[model samples]
Target: MKLSQLLEYDPIIVQCHDNPDADAIASGYAIYEYFKEHSKNVRFVYSGRNAIQKSNLLLLINYLKIGDVLEHIEEWKDDEFEGLVVTVDCQYGAGNVTRIPAKYVAIIDHHQKEIENVELSEIVSGLGSCSTLVWRMLREEGFDLDDIKINTALYFGLYTDTNSLSEINNPFDKDMRDMIAYEKSVIIILRNSNFSLDELEIAGNAMKNYLYYPKNRFAVIKAKQCDPNILGLISDFLLQVAEVDEAIVYNEWPGGFKYSVRTCVKEVHADELASFIAEGIGSGGGHIEKAGGFIRRDLYEAKFKDLDTEEFFRTRIDEYFDTFEVIYASEYEADISKMELYAKKKIHQGFVIAKDILPIGTPVIVRTLEGDIETEVSDDLVFMIGIKGEVYTNHREKFERSYQMTDIEYLSDDELLKPEYLPTVHSRNDGSVIDLSKHAHVCISSGATQICACQIDKRVKIFTKWYTETYMAGKPGDYLAVRTDDPHDVYIVERDIFFRTYEKME
Candidate 1:
């Protein structure tokens, strides 16, 4: 999983998916550079029916002189590779990557898990690009990223993979964009050289004919097999129409279909819709306004059983809008007659004083598995770390009223604050990452007043009073609760968390 693990093998081969894009090349290049720097023999190569012919990719390679180390391998003299083979941006043995036999196989990918069971693998599907994964891995190993070529390649990889960063939502992806000191002029040239004349014609033809569903004010277009970024371009352009609030554009490729989703309406988040379209079959995620996904053809065939792809998309989109109910917490009133009163159980939690960590008025981003929360450090701003290691903000006044600080230390036991991914705080001004757990101290609830709550039967997107900009998603069986003291103060409690921390009041 870590870059250091691969150092055991010598003469390592770094391979990318066939028809390598900027992301694949960048990821492979980073790994190659890391191994090379460590004095390990490594060669970055890609094997497929076609070589890198895309104009933008060619420009990127030429500008960085990566072609010096990168090889377009077609034929192999040896029946099997002797050393370790590390597949980047694509899983080993997947339809997308050519199966190069090796003594040891490792996968570094940022796609839906298609090929599993490999011992050496690092795949985070939520990331916009594999480059971010490699960057993080290299940084963990203390690999130097000061080289201009590597930095620029990594930046372009993320830029192209996330559709010029418009679709990037993951905090890690954002961190890479922020941390990398890349060549802006080179990136501009590579971006401008993205579309070739043939691709431009394909986009033009694809846009001329589109399916518009008036009821939903959405458009879906199936473009000719082209670069995945072209799908984003088509969707973005289509969404500009007066009647269209959302656009879905997709294209079929070698092993699967790549699609892009765009939305301008707050009621519908593009990332949520993108995930909905690819549920169970693939992976999808990005920013609220723009997002994209990939659906494996094999998975699609197995599930849909010969269903038309377009028809399936139409049905899927309809289901997305029909399945969820939206709630604006400020206006909705809780019906206490039907809901039971539930009070917070006395549970040990953690808290961090804002002023203690950073100066007042200093901007900081709280990074969690769920997402990033932006808050400026202030004397009154208190950050509460939940029992699950999740965080919520509170004012000093409310912190004193709702909970009491304890002298106990934050526990490190099985039933306590052992999170899968530990939370961190990053100063936006200085780009410094702070391990949040280090600053946290234990606290206990004051047995806050009961709230009328009930389990939701359907999917809900509630814009809680605290977070008015973005809505919190709640699935069936999740609790929707309204504070008794202030009915307008509404929120959602995850099902497991609700059961773990709350008890019905007698």
Candidate 2:
């Protein structure tokens, strides 16, 4: 829901999850500011067993001067008041948030859905932080982020929640990190004040006690109840050990488990392994080398029942390694005996000429849902947008030979390719972001290119000749494919997409 919708009620009150963190405080403060701008009687307050005590949080509150409205209310006054009470960074009546009585209640959160009875609520889970969600909502209402305090609060909220932005996975989080302007001095102060002596002891103790699986050279350490960011620090330090190739650090929270994964090996991407470990139980993602995840206690108990948490992690890691076969296309040959020959079907896709939008030699970072890729704008470089809205680099010669230009114009969100976020290129020269769709045109597959493809029953990781550092993961039912003309050129096709875009030849 839009922030303006809550303006209808007077004397509106903003609430955050109990024991408010940086994200919670920032989110509520933003709402309070939005209402204050509208001249609405708004009060931002939080209630819990204790008031804010964290050093960095106190610094954030003092620096932003939010102490005036953002307060700790032992008991909410204005009994039987007819106004709206909005919860930010948390859902109303959830395990983390304290429920306050009001005539109308609304929730703005970026956590798993829990309170469904609230009609006026906005909850988009899987975001890096609630601050990004609030920032996006404020932007929708045309709220200016020029206020350095607001910018810093939002940035710090993201920074703290996502472990200094090393655990950020969503595009919205990255966009906020790049586009938003904040006071560096204030951020530095808050960041340095993050760890207390007790937390330092917790980190040190966690390191001394760890479960090591010698086979995979991975270490799992459980820190005593501490800040989630502490888990990241522990994992980062754990990965520096010469024998440890990957590290998993965790700390228990009231609601669930907070875990961080760090990996120095290319065989297992930290983000991918984190996601695999939390697959059906919770949400997890980040960068290749560093990532984090949250496992809901309810979901964990429901699935594993009485299983030890350590064993669960160990088994998951083992499954992650055992189920997948890593294939380097450059050194591998395909056997067609068990594979079937398939021809490409005529399908309209999006394409962007590399030189059309940027200078021929401009260095750029292409950002997509898949990941960010570094390349330079060149005459021979072409970007091919697949049916799933994924963008990939293609050679101009191959693009001409394998596809035909189409008259159909490309739109960011088409019925065929309903992409979550359209691809964009950020120039390293001047730090400008260019939407690839602006210079995009449609193309039709030639239907002459053929591949020997076979559905895979096991997990596969294919490092094609192009991307040596990153491998595309293929799960069961996905196709392992090789170009008919070049048996060594291997790749994977997702189950649904493979069937939709290819047909077996007679």
Candidate 3:
């Protein structure tokens, strides 16, 4: 139906966008008054609720007796608005109005065109404010605006929609002039619209975790579940941060995430970007410069489970720095090979050898630069060996109390020759003696010698002068033989465990 046909209907319902903002409310009221002058059955409706921060507008609305035209669907009479439904400031099925029936006759808005099938649609994308469009319509119809309440409503509609005239460029000066001529007190509106502490806290938390991606020319923030009004607050705050071209806020909601994307980049479309991110995951659509979307929690977790947030940002930053690579070539290419080599060597030599063997028991000895330190055999230290080594001794009782082959590894001769050994050596059970050739650094244990007695008892005397002569010949990674009186118990000690002399000979 045309505007003339829509005007012919009885009990017309004038609806605005869901959760009507100042522009939506003002434009809705302006149309409400226009229709009320010609008809008595007109009613106004909004899709969702408003916040307490909009108290000033609410007061103005109540004072102007606009509440008389307002009627929530739940409060509507069964025979209400059967003639026509005229939607202003929003289109039907645009996610802005809830439960709009198939009878919508006209839509007047300043947003991008939606609801292609409307009988009459007036979407002025060039207009800075939806209220301005309503003002134009009222003027074109020669409606006299003698009431201060109507002027005040139109003024707020223009001012708030333009973000107090901060959003429009200088080219829109005539529009600004027309808005200023209405003479709305901005200070009064702002002062009366102060947000509560809870609202302020919600905005503060959103800004704290803000992350910027210069390559994408966007900033992303995570906001707590909050009033939808806070989306505007976050966008405003992000615009003030230096160098940010676009701001996107993801707010956590029940089982899903809601996103509000805004940008000053005229060439970069926010709605396109929002749609791209929401594709195949959720739904989103809005004006070219500003858009919002929602993603379910399951979808987000599944897609980003492997993402490391810190590394993700670091990689983006690194990509940004890639653009200026030639400017810092020398600093970026400095060698780190020395540090890597040192780390590799340290890991190779730091090995542990268990003192007593048990399927899984305590009392393990870990050999490090400090010395052989005793510790318990636990799952924590099980990964310290290359392969398991076996130990054998004729004095089974002595071996049980004194030695465990739970772990072992090679060390440099200098590391193994330290006289400052641990004071907790176990007593040897066999009384034996060994002759050490100082020149050759050789130690040969025999059943008749004191080494045999030392094996039986824990206390043992080492002839260091002769032992070093025979054992201190080898380099860092060789093996040596440690013979026992029991031929079945003989095993070879790693050459790296011997002194430099023996290691070098091998």
Q: Per-model C-alpha lDDT, please?
A: 0.84, 0.84, 0.50
lDDT of 2 at 74: 62
Model 1, C-alpha of 308: deviation from truth (Å): 4.6
The window of 10 residues in a row where model 2 has the poorest summed lDDT is 412-421
Residue range 174-275, candidate 3, lDDT tens digits: 343454345356436643574557767888887887887776567877777665556866876796677787777766656556677676753445665565
lDDT of 1 by residue, 1-506 (tens): 78899889987999998668899998898888888888998888887645777788888889878767789877555788889999999888775566888999999998766676898989776678999999999899888889888899999999988868877666689899988998999988888997899989989999898999999899999999876667777888899999999899998877788888999987898979998898999867666778787888899989998898789888999999999989899998778798998898988888888888888998887876566677789889988888788887878987888888976656553346566556788887777778887788777888885688999999999887766767789999999988888898788899999988889989
Lowest-sum lDDT 10-residue window in model 3: 450-459
Rate residue 462 of model 1 by lDDT.
86
Candidate 1 residue pairs in backbone clash: none
**Cα TM-score per model:** 0.83, 0.78, 0.53
Cα miss at 214, model 1 (Å)?
3.9
Judged by whole-model lDDT over C-alpha atoms, candidate 1 comes out at 0.84
47-141, model 2: which lDDT tens digit per residue? Answer: 76557767798889998887776878766565765888899988877645656778999999876565778989887765788999999999999
Candidates by lDDT, descending order:
1, 2, 3
Q: What C-alpha lDDT, on a 0 to 100 scale, does residue 95 get in candidate 3? A: 51
Number of backbone-clashing residue pairs for each candidate, in the order shown: 0, 0, 52
Residue-level error in angstroms, candidate 2, position 433: 2.5
